[model samples]
Target: MVAALLAAVSVAADPATTASAGEQGAWFSDPVVVSGQNTAEPGIEVAPDGRLYVNAPAGLLADLPGAASFLWRSDDGGATWVLTPPGLRAAFPGGGDSDVAVDPQGATVYFSDLWVGSSTAAVSDDRGNSWFASPLSGVVIHDRQWLATSGGGVVYLAYNQIPAGVMVSKSVDGGRTFVVHSLAASVLDRSGCVCPPGTMVVEEGTGPAGLADRVGVVYATSTGGVGFARSVDGGLTFAQVTVAPARDGIDTTRAFPVVANAGPGQLVAVWQEVVEGQRTRVQFSGSADWGRSWSDPQVVVDAGTPLFPWVDANGGGKVGVSLYHTDQATLPDAAPDDAVWFERYLESLDGGQTFSPLVTVDPTPVKTGPICTQGAACAQDRELLDFQAVAIDTDGLALLTWARSIDNVADTEIRFARQLTDEATTAAPTLHLHDAVGDAITRPLPWLFRTATWSPTGR
Candidate 1:
């Protein structure tokens, strides 16, 4: 006997919010302050139980002592947040960038930073209540250290391998020990230093039997292009694939690639670049059957110069990309004036075939200025060190987070906005029924069936 009760969902445009549905289907929320105490290079993640975690460089030059990092947690989603107690201080005296990730169960949280001579991490197993610090076993992590945790507690850390290539350190037993895997490109040019952080996603290992669990990482190579590396047997070894060919305008300021696993064997990656004769724009491509192949690149956002594009995907083929955009000059021209910079977003409900309209995320305007550090390069770039982040909750809400320089760069604050659209509303898990085995079953449609293997007797 099969009996299921699922709520009927509908679609309508929400006019009061920027996440309104239109020609391309969009949903954007108002900006809210996660923290006002000088946050930089923010990283955001959502727990399985609806908790939100954000970590970043705590403050500017005047906020603290000995290069500190800040941790913030929200029990009520992103509606509110509080700074985690006992902040982490750098083992060394310098700070460049940091990233954070939570275990699949949300029982453990990990934060990474450049230590005295290598990349180190601060771990909290008690849901950010406390912490302990340690190095990444044997590898030397560069300035931008990124962290990602698999459902089975495998921790993967990716960073630049000095002169060339990207190295990933994997730990199967909750980061106790690591096996480093190198993914070097033959065309890696070291003459110019441009090492962007590599973004990784652990494939959902719930597919058919005999399918090797995969972990994918995407980053920009020294050549002005994006490279993808996949590991089939955990993180022991990796095979590389070029998502986009090398171009002429691949600089640290313009080339940031973000990647995500949409579903079983479905992967998507996005990055920003300038063609030799075209304007700067964001290009996207994906692979339905893992990284064995990928679709051609297509422009997703090109209103102005879309800087630092970041992408994230959910289990149901929903992908989100966020970036700091500016309406500057096109390629082959001098750097355009640093006009007002704003945050923008793009989403694809059906993998990478189509995307929603270019939606403006933050309503506030950000102004850039010359670097205040004496003797620094004469580049008038905005202080956005890294890229923004987008994470989808189980309920299909997209939470976009970033550090916005407000009040004329005098104080940078961590900010975020929530976006919800008709697609998300219809996909909401409003009603769930249990099967004969007492496992919760969520049926989006009468014909679409999904199962959770839970035992009522005991584990």
Candidate 2:
């Protein structure tokens, strides 16, 4: 039965396409500005009811006393957005890194606010109108915090704990309270850099019987490698797996690896590494049996210097990866140049086996020069922060949020872009079924359809 299912959804015949020099006829709608003030390091999520939510640190708003992160909601997709009321202070008042996640049933929305030495998690049931905030108790000094949710009121918060390592806290009673679930990484794994962990995802256990839902996270290890931690029994315990071994040119400070679930027991990891000639490329690897093993790393984009890569997957083998790309090959400390940077996206219909032609989400340059990698220490060109986010909605349309620097120094704003075409229809049909023997199975049907295009206004 397993062999039959694999044959039905095989994507080996689909050839990979090269990155095109021209845009694909407005494949992505014009980016809509989502923030009125300067904000960086944006994160986005789509609730089950199709409501969109974006969160970021209160950049200029932080100057005001008792100010927290910013939250924006959109009912009419990405066409327009409304900012929530200001001064929703968390436990720490001083807002830093921000992340947002919604429960599987869309009954609750979770948001994280990271301050200098600690962090807080907020929950909202009636959208963003009201929120109840609680301080995360497991970690004493939290650097960056990310949220992930699954069925049964399960929520996982992953973050770096000062000089220790990566820690994950679980909240089974909605987001009211949380306790340390497990240590994703140890002090030995972190070496000395308290690098932030990538996005966290809860993979529904739709495989054989007795298999429970799994929570997975990826982060940069001290040995210059990518580490993946998986918890099969909810967030009770996690076993770390080395997705990619130590490499010579990997910059541990900024080498944040992101993981996404394409299907049951199927995971993909994407990160950035410097090549032989000092050119940085986005690399990805795939695992069919959860995080037990991973395929050799493959280049997703090598034409330009890519930074802050993010990945998200849906359906059978459909995956989307987004990153900031620039043609100039300059060092991080190089002076500001005329080089232009844009946000680029690539999709895969067959899991991570192959990818389609690169699509520029926005033609406008987000930044004009070198981006400072030194956190909070760089004196210039640090407006656009470290990471951006990408989410595949229920309709399989990609939604992206990132910070754009207008002056390349301090003036920054949050912007959003959405895929205009219905890429989900073009892929094979995904079906989850139970075998005759009673074990669960997931596979794609032998059928395909032409791509359909739509505009944001029509939706």
Candidate 3:
């Protein structure tokens, strides 16, 4: 039955909440905004029916006219979102970062973006209301990363071939047909200049089959280091490397590198480093031989770096990381620091060899500019680029979404918290119930029976 449910949870999926059993450092509980509409620049994913597939970036920026961009959906899992009314657009003119995946058993629901000069692609399978501006054969689908789904139809697209760096694409018969492959060059140093938006994953049992589908890729290199790739099928082929490996001191600050394999072979990542004097910490890494090797970093959150981690092992893996903390040396232009912020620590135990001291899925401190535009570089030059992601359902609950800058632009509209599933009675229980038997219920787990088919054994 789908490889027996992906080989029995394959990896990462055991945390009935109740802090899974509490005491990893428990404190999680405070985050709830869900849907959004302050105006343009939104992109989130996580929808097969579990809901939370937002995509509102109404971007009228240079397109002048107005309202043309859309794709808003939030069916409760995201708290309260609804605007499929007449959005979803990308004839090109700023409507970036929108990658959603859902085809584990076939109702079909996938979305992708990246239309700058125009390789022309604005696909959607009815989940976002509507969209279809295809042209991927035009051969220009750079830095894309959706990775997953070997369930039978095939859908694995790990991209980044711009200027020349990173590649792995496959649609099998599912994503509509694709098969691009070009991996390893020490794993991308490709002339340099990446970092517009790059985050990939794939490398557990290795995708398409065996249920270990994880193909990871992260780019933001001035060389600050963050570019790796691995495709266990699904994406077809890949095996690149270049890790900044060496946590504790944290160091990365170029901020933006979040990977997730959760199981199969275990590979979790986090990024945000600017450690010359220390303050931009948010470092965590792992690779159970998938990327060859890694492990020896843990700084959780301090200067913060826009991290988002999720793993609920029905087999044994549970973690959720999200940290922002930015005023950038005192309002380096106020950036995304509208002020009232805090999603802190968050812990649900069961998957930790090093970092595990979180528990604030939503304690609500809230504050960080909602500026949708001022100079816009993901808003005043990347302060953490408005949330964009954090998902986990099937009974674990911890869906997060963010984007509310103050002066940089895109204001008060995209917000979500979820963190449901509790049971910690008290010791300090103001609201720290990371769930153990805390039940909030969010069912939807399929596609893992070791991954369902397609293996090469890392050759």
By lDDT, the best candidate is: 2
Error of 3 at 222 (Å): 20
Determine which window of 10 residues in candidate 1 has minimal summed lDDT: 1-10
In model 3, what is the error at residue 404, expressed in angstroms?
A: 2.7
Model 1 misplacement above 4 A: 1-26, 59-66, 86-94, 136-138, 179-194, 204-212, 247-253, 327-338, 368-380, 421-459
Q: What's the residue-level lDDT of 79 in candidate 1?
A: 66
lDDT of 3 by residue, 164-273 (tens): 55555655555555545555323336334443435565433433443345556655455455656655554445565655643344334344576765556666666666
Q: How many clashing pairs per prediction, in order?
A: 2, 0, 101
lDDT for each of the candidates?
Answer: 0.60, 0.71, 0.45
Query: In model 3, which runs have C-alpha deviations exceeding 4 angstroms?
Result: 1-41, 44-98, 101-109, 112-154, 157-171, 176-198, 201-216, 219-227, 231-240, 243-248, 251-255, 258-271, 281-402, 405-411, 414-459
> What is the full ranking by TM-score, best candidate first?
2, 1, 3
TM-score of each: 0.76, 0.85, 0.28
Candidate 2 residue spans exceeding 4 A from truth: 1-22, 60-65, 86-92, 190-193, 204-212, 332-336, 422-453, 457-459
Question: 1-459, model 1: which lDDT tens digit per residue?
Answer: 000001111111121222321222224545668888765567788776667888776433223234547778888667678888644434422244567788876578877655424555667787778766665443663545577877555677777666455667766666655655555332243224345456777764543321355777776665666777777766667777877776675442344577776766777788767655455677787877677666666666655556667887766767788876655544413443455566777676656544554566776654443222111242434455556788877766567888777665446888877764332223332224333345554433311112222111111
- Model 2 lDDT on a 0 to 1 scale: 0.71
CA shift of 238, model 2, Å: 2.0
- The better candidate by TM-score, 1 or 3, is 1
